[model samples]
Target: MSTPYEVEHGVTAGQTGRRPQNRRVDMESFFSFLHQISTDAISSVSSETTPQTHNNRHAEATPVDTANLFRLLQDQFATLRQTSPDATNRDFLEALIQEVDRDIADLPRLHGVGQEFLDGLDRVSKKEILKGKKGEEKCPICAVKFNEDPHPLVVALPCHTSHCFDLECVAPWLQSKGTCPMCRKNFVRKKEEKKELKEDSEEEEEFDNMNGVWLATGYPQTVIAIRGVDEKGLALVRNGVEVL
Candidate 1:
């Protein structure tokens, strides 16, 4: 006699039934952390030893060649009134490095926004990538043949090309990886973690049932999470297993 509203509100199932609103904040925190690490490595500024004038080094072609970039950017922001006032702040900051730029400004526009640098990067990357398109590989999941195209099923190891696996299959394995089998890359997510949490929460709720009797959530949630586990593991712990 469980009401639909009760099911919707997670009075019965806690974790799996959660909506996007309940998950957005957590997802954002995860991705923001990802963005910070990626940007830092991509945008690092470096100093190089001057071949000549070793004693009085000039910043000619250093990663953050401030003088060169500034002169170029001034022409870019010439239409803006605010750039002149805070020009000093520009000295300390260098150009933000970007990855995989794909936009190209048309030449007939008769202006320079420096988008060309990224477009050139894109072109170079495209050429280099095209040069490497000679081989064919088959997807592990769908068995589709691909030439210079990613196997939708494959997950490529960052360090090596021989380390690809079915992406869908690999993700679940990675959630519990805690470490890569080959490279010892550590990752951990017990698929059963949230189930355990839900089970614990359900047990708490059952204790609070207070009406001299309580009904089992028949959670099936936990059991489903651990379905592929060993037979002995299920023998003693089947009560919480969702029979579905």
Candidate 2:
């Protein structure tokens, strides 16, 4: 027998709790179908001819100022997220931030995004464009092979060289003087310092039970639209409040 509740909701009593996702939903196919529908709708709307038909379509459809509405929402979300860590324990904010970063960078390849994606990231965060280093690139301070990870008290530098110092080994030393011990190529000390300081600050700012959070500003429009994205990022924030 069909219940009044089930009937109102367009479902039969027998179908209750029988969600496809719970049982045998092919998520990939579902997503593909959704994508197909979206692309089709977009094409239909865009290809519509004549101002009259366009106007009629606009009148018939629900009105939504997508751009402005998105901007407003994003601004609100960014502020709330930025303050989450400071106001609360921080677990909420850190996850949100990472999610935002990842989402911003990733776009459906169907969209045909070019190198423009790389252009959106902050230069300080981008991978150092690797350049070829010269002969037997021996770390001046440590004198070790160039291809492996640095050992304790050994600091790795550009040019595939290792100096016997950790980030702390040469952070201050490099901060004051921006040159690698082995190679004179300018080392990015300020950026590294800021990163280290931020991590430390995040750790100290909240208890262990909470996630570390840091507020960042100056995200690009693309970043806001896609979500928080940078080199290392996630899809979305957890609970609509935190990123992880």
Candidate 3:
């Protein structure tokens, strides 16, 4: 008959069965060994791949324009400071906001001139534009044939040669430039004429200062003297009064 310990542990009567204390210790050691192997493998993989991944990320990174970025940051910070007065960094924020505001105020302001210039241009019909053409006239703005286009809105400029443009095309352009696209003539005729007259007066003043007093001699008389005095020192006389 088999002993109780032998039957329970599946050991022979002469062979000893493993103690419970030793069995627990062996199981702990086996688990510890497995955990250590797993840790070592993970460490090895990380050490091998980490440098290469970091190098790739560094190589692919793009450089930023720091000056522009700093300016943008300063503007945003100034705006924030304006909105929140009780926040920190009061002095620096005030200075930055003041500088931005000064720059904005220094820019030239255009008022009612743009709208008035656009309104002054003559709006003409497509039939008037193509009055003498044999169905071959094209709009200078859209580059489309007048016969083919359904819309009939066209604007004629007051240029010496009378250049016409499509209303839709020239309206937006006039708001900003206020000039004819083809001839580059100013839409505000009176303003342009005044400017030219002022420039001419300035030039005449400069010329009068450089030369002696021929102030009373008109432009026609001056031109005649210039032509007649081809080889002599011609003195201009206004009403028989000789000017040196």
How far residue 75's Cα lies from its native spot in candidate 1, in Å, is: 61
lDDT of each: 0.28, 0.31, 0.40
Clashing pairs in 1: 178-186, 178-187, 179-185, 180-185, 220-242
Clashes of 2: 12
Top lDDT prediction, candidate number: 3
Clashes of 1: 5
Cα RMSD for candidates in order = 26.2, 28.9, 38.5
Q: Rank the candidates by lDDT, best first.
A: 3, 2, 1
Best candidate (score: TM-score): 3
> Across residues 51-134, which tens digit of lDDT does each residue of candidate 3 receive?
111222222111122222223324443444544434333454465445434434444221112334544567666575456462
On TM-score, the stronger of 2 and 3 is: 3
| 1 or 3, greater by TM-score | 3
Q: What is the lDDT of candidate 2?
A: 0.31
Candidate 2 Cα errors over 4 Å, as ranges: 1-153, 162-164, 188-244
Candidate 2 lDDT, tens digit per residue, 1-244? 3322233235543554422221111122222222232221211111122211221333221112222222222332344443342443144334433433443444311211112221222221112212234223432322222332211122354434333332312332232224543354444454467789999988775533232333344764322122344567643443355444
Compared with the true structure, what per-residue lDDT tens digits does model 1 show for residues 16-100? 3322221111122222222232221111111221111222233122322322332333322232222322433232121111100
